[model samples]
Structures are given as structure tokens and as C-alpha cells.
Target: MSIWRSYPRSLKVLLLAMLVNSTGMAFLWPLHTIYITQGMGKTLSEAGFVMMLHSAAEIIGSFLGGYLYDRIRGKRTLLLAVLSSACFIFIISIGLSWPVYILMMILLGLGIGTIFPPIYALAGSIWKEGGRKSFNLIYLVLNFGVAIGTALGGIVAQFSFQYVFWVNGFTYLLFIFIVWRALDEPDPVYEAAQKKALDPRPKKEFRPLQSFYSLLILCLGFMFCWVTYIQWQTSISTYIHLLGFPLSSYSALWTINGLLILLGQPLLQWFMDRVKSPVKWQLLSGVIFFILTFALLSQNQSYGGFVTGMVIMTIGEILIFPAVPAIADRLAPLDRRGMYQGLVSGAANVGRTIGPLLGGLLFDGFGPLVLLYSCIFICGFALICFGTYQRLQYIQKEVSTVKVNK
Candidate 1:
């Protein structure tokens, strides 16, 4: 099926809006560590700390955005976030004092965090028929945006740092205006689903707190899986630089990662859907990721070796990343979809929060090999967690079957 056929007009518009927004974000992401450390003259530790703060703020934003999305319509909430993000970008571009920079980071995190729940909500609502394919398309568009954004940012950063932020900010402005004019409220079906959940049906009372805790654990496991990967954005550049590559080369490597995702994710999704076992896909991917991370350590300081490892890592990403949202959707009650998705993003932020700080400490004290070894251990633990989750799911299914038979 043509991916476009799966979505209606309004959803198409929303997807495009997300594409534009993510493209803008992609411009800043790979360059964020570079900007703070090289452009702004902060230490590696300082930059990592700032990034942790940003991710921490995102955790709050994700929760708040998800909560508000459940109560309010998504469009209004999204508009507010887009506007706030634009304002934050402008402020951060001017190179404020430490406190102001920290404040701006919080706002940026909140604004960015707000974007995901609505986007995911829209995808979940609009493409109910398409199932995993719909989510995969959304993921595809997002990665495409990242590819374009990172490639553009890398090229621009080669000439001027300010241009990266300016372009990113401008794109956000464009996204805000486009979404304001183009996207409508969700379709009636989704609206009805929202209303139905509130109509007091007693199938299983939606326990928001219990579901939230479950999602939190899932997110933490996700964090453990991804903490190592996030370092590719922050410390890996410095590590590469130490190996005698120019800063621009690091950016190019990121662009390569994005490109691989653009090419690989859809195919991976296709394979994943056919497998009939999301948990198995996740566990296997985690194990592969662990092995690949260890291989990266062996290739330390070799440009070819690093690129090869990154390619393998990207393959693991293609398998693991898209599976997350689908898994969350299955675990969450319909009423709590927004909050569960928020937890997923928040857990990722937690991973982001820990990844860079730990990576920096490892690189500074123990060196690159230690960091890679540590990542192997983290991925190993995540693999075990996923295995257990799968087993529990099997047990639950068996119990449900027994009850139905009785």
C-alpha cells in the first residue's frame, strides 16, 4: 500500500507539520553538543550537564503535554508548544547567561516534549485501520525529516553555527503557521473513542496511576536500552575528534546514521510486523545492539571501524525504536494513551539524561573502551528485561484464555 493512502487529508497535513518540525529539530540535535562545547567554549562535562538538564525538563514537558492532551484537544495544546519552542529558540540563539540558558533549556524541553504526544495521538487516532504500518510511516517521515535536517545542519555548520539555529527557528515558525492554517481537529471516530472512554463503561476501570507506573518501568527499561545510543549524539563526536577527524566529519557521520534510518526503518518495520512477536524482535535487537556496542570498543580510534559499528548500531535502532510505541499502545488503556506515550518519551529523556553524563565521565576517566563496555552491560540488562516482559505477556494471555474457556 502506498503510505499516503493510509492517511486521510488532515492526517497528511499533521504528518507534514511533524516533518517540518522535526527537520528543524534535526538541525540542532547533532550540533547541540558541538555548539555548547566548541562554539560556546564549555567543557565536555558542562555540555553533558546542560544536556541532562534539557532532557530532565523534557520529562516534565512530556508528562504535562500528555496530561493536557487528554483533557484538551490536541491542536490547541500543540499550537502553544510550537509557539513556546520558537520563543525559546530565539532566546537561546543569543547566548544568554548560565541561568538564562538553563531556563531556556527547560522551555525548549517542554516545548519539544509537548510536540510528541499530540503527534502520536494524531497517528493513533487517524490510522486505526493501518495499525503498525501507520506508525511506521510516521516513523519514516520523522526519520526523513531528521535526515534532511541533520544533512542541512552539517553543511551549514561547516560555514557558520548561527545559521543552524536560525534555520531551525525559522522552520519552527513555518511549522507553527502551517499547522495553524492547515491541520484541523481530529476526526469524529477518535473524538468518539475519547468520549466513550469517559462514558463509565465498567469493562476494566482505567487505573491511570497503575498504568502510569507500569509505563514508567517500561520506559526505564527503554532508557537502559538507549542510554548508550544517545551518546552517539554528544560524546561520540568528541571521541571522533580525538581520533583526528574534523568536527565536520562527526556531523557527516550523524547524517549517515540518519540516512541509514531513512533507508532501513521501513524494511525493518515490515519484517517486525510479520514476525508476530514484538517482544522477540525487541529482545533480539537488544542483544544485537549489545554485541555491536562491544564491537565498537574493539574498533576504537579507527574511522572505518567506528563507521562500521555505527552502521550496525543503526540496524539495531531500526528494529528497536519503532517497536516501542506499539508496545506502549498495547499495554495502556485507551483513555490513558497520551500519558503512556508521554512516559515512553520521558523514559527516553531519562536515557538521554544519563547517557551523556555517564559517557562523559567514562570518556574523561576511563576512556572510550570503558564507555563501550559499560554500554554492552546496559544493553545486556535491557535484553533480559524484555525477555521477562515477553514471558509475563504469555502468562497473561494464557490466563485470559483460561477464563474465557471457563
Candidate 2:
């Protein structure tokens, strides 16, 4: 209670808003593949195509949202995002047909995409003293919403998916109200910080380009990470349903995935406290867990095996999600923070756009063995990308240090 209350107004509101929005968002996604496959009688490949378009729109929104955050600095961008998303949710609840549903999904993706980067930038702006704690708390609240929403969503979906739509729209309505009431004010401290977190040229001590280049490298690896991570949401769900598990079982796994993150926050904080270079170690160690997840999945056919894989994957997710944005905050100048944050979201959206389409194609052409093998390769490749970025960063710092001495 004290800890939550200690956060700045903007931070607290962001957390609450995300939790509220995610409660509704959670109800929509897990059922997406199932709804398309079972309810609409569509093929997985077709569903993947629709999801690809949705993700592409999300990428557009990410860039737009970033642009807006940098130019305009308050609730207006967020309100636009949430309000549009609410409209989509409401429309989708009313009608869930073929082309209309797909179009609305793309619109919904854009709306949701528009909402994120500003809040992330807000965390840095509003809670300067808390460092990564601000972002991590947001991530934690996001999954906390996931845990509760998925658990209930699964049960609600068991009755009628129409109910899922209604409830989701209701939550979005709530989200709109929260954003309006809480985020309407502007703070100049946050405004100045939003322009440039640090002076890039401090007596030739730092390269002006370091922060931007660092963000680029980070975005590249993070993109691949999402490419791998998203398969669990899209193709993996389809794969599970194909294996004869109930739809409820498919959603139950997400419930478990969320539940672990909620419970493991304490242990993760403890682990972070003991670590040396948290960002690098967390990246490397978490990808290793991702490797382990694909390795486990490649052979296992049982629900228990999937359950075990979800647990391991959630560990990886916990380590990675909050850390990436926090690292971005460090690497960004005030002027580019929103752009950097948007790029991170853009990368993830790109991955999300591609992961399902490619995974679906791979699954359709090759067997599950091949799909699983491909993920192993993807995860390994992401490891290489991030590892190489770390090396390049070291080289850049060394070169800069040499220049400073001269």
C-alpha cells in the first residue's frame, strides 16, 4: 500500500490504466486463434494473415504515438488511443463476422499500439528517481492484469465468447474514464526531461551518437526476441488445440504464464539485486531460458510438458520485458526518448506481425518438429544479436575513452 502510494501520480495512474486495459486486452487475444479456427471455420494460415495486418497497423500506431509524445506532451495522445480502441472493442462486441472482424482487429491493433509508448515515456518523465522501478512496476502490473483476466477470461469464454467481447468492451470504457481523469495535467519537470535526459556532449566525455546507436542495436535484438516470443501466443495456441486439448486448456496456459510472473516478481527482484550487470545478464540468461523452452517443446506432446515450457518461458519474459525499456531509457537523449520507446514498440510490433505469418507457414508446410527447430534457431539467433550488441557497445565505449584521453 505504502509502496504503491509512494509512486508519482502519473506513474500510479499509468499502472492502474495498464492493469485495467490489460484485463480487457487479455480476454481478446488468447481466444483469437480459437475463435477464428472454431467459430468462423477459418484456416490457421488465413488467421495468421489477419494477425499480420493487425500487427502492421500496430507498427504504424507505434510510430505515430512516438511522434505525438515528442511533439505533444500530455493525455491527448493517450486519450485518442484509448478512445479509439474502446470504439473498436465496442464494435467488435456487437459483430464478429469474417472481413469486418478482421478490419476491426487491425483498427484495434492500431489503437492499442498508440497507447503504449506515451505511457512508457511518462514513466521516465514522472518517476525520475525510481529509475527502472517505474517501468518494471508497469510491466508487473500488466502481467498482473493478465493473470486475473486470463483466469476469468478462460471461464467466461467457456460459456460464450460473445460474453468475452462484452466484458472486454466494458473494461475499455473503464480505461477511457481512468485516462481522462488522471492524465489530463502537464508537469514542466517532466516536460524538460522529455526533451533530453542528458547532455550528450559533456566536454567530449561522451559521443552524441552513442545513445541513438545503442537504441538501434537494442531494437534489433528485441525485435527478434518478440519474433520468438509471439509464437506462443499465435502458432503455439493453434498447435495445442490441434493436439486435442480443450480451448479452456489453451487459455489456462496463459493463466499459468501470468500467474508465475505475478508470484515470481519477488524472486526476480531478489535475483536482480544479487546480479552485477542486470541488463546484459538478464538478456543472456533469459534467452538461455527461451532456448530451454523451445528445446522442451520440440519433443513434448503432453499438456504437462507444455505446462513446464510455459513456466520456463515466463521466467524469460519476466527478465526481459521491463529490462529492455529501462535500458532504452538509459540510452535515450531527452529529445529521442519517445522515438526510442516507439522504436522498441515498433520492433515488437514488427515481430508480432511476422511471427504468426511465418510460424503459420512453417507449421503448414513442415511438421511441428520443424517449427520447433526453427524457434530454437530463432532464439539462438536473437542471443547472437544481443550478444554482439553488447560487444559493439564495449568497443564504442573504449574508442570514446581513447578519444577523450587524446
Q: Per-residue lDDT for 198-308 in model 1, tens only?
A: 454544333444445555556666888778788787577777888888877776676678888887777766666677655556657756775675666556677777777
By TM-score, the best candidate is 2
Error of 2 at 210 (Å): 2.5
Candidate 2 on 1-406: residue-level lDDT in tens?
A: 8976787887777788889988888888878777778878999778767877887899999988888887775477888888888789788877577989999999988988988888788787776667778888888898888777876887898998889988988888888788888764446665565434543344333543766676777788888788889899778988998999998898788778877888897678667867655577788888889989989999898999999999999899888888888878776666676787898889888988788778878988996788888988888777876776656556778897888799
lDDT of 1: 0.75
Q: In model 1, which runs have C-alpha deviations exceeding 4 angstroms?
A: 33-46, 94-98, 154-163, 187-214, 244-249, 274-279, 299-301, 390-406
State candidate 1's TM-score.
0.84
Which regions of candidate 2 deviate over 4 angstroms?
32-46, 94-102, 154-166, 184-208, 238-249, 299-302, 390-393
Residue 325 displacement (Å), model 1: 1.2
Q: lDDT (CA) for every model shown?
A: 0.75, 0.81
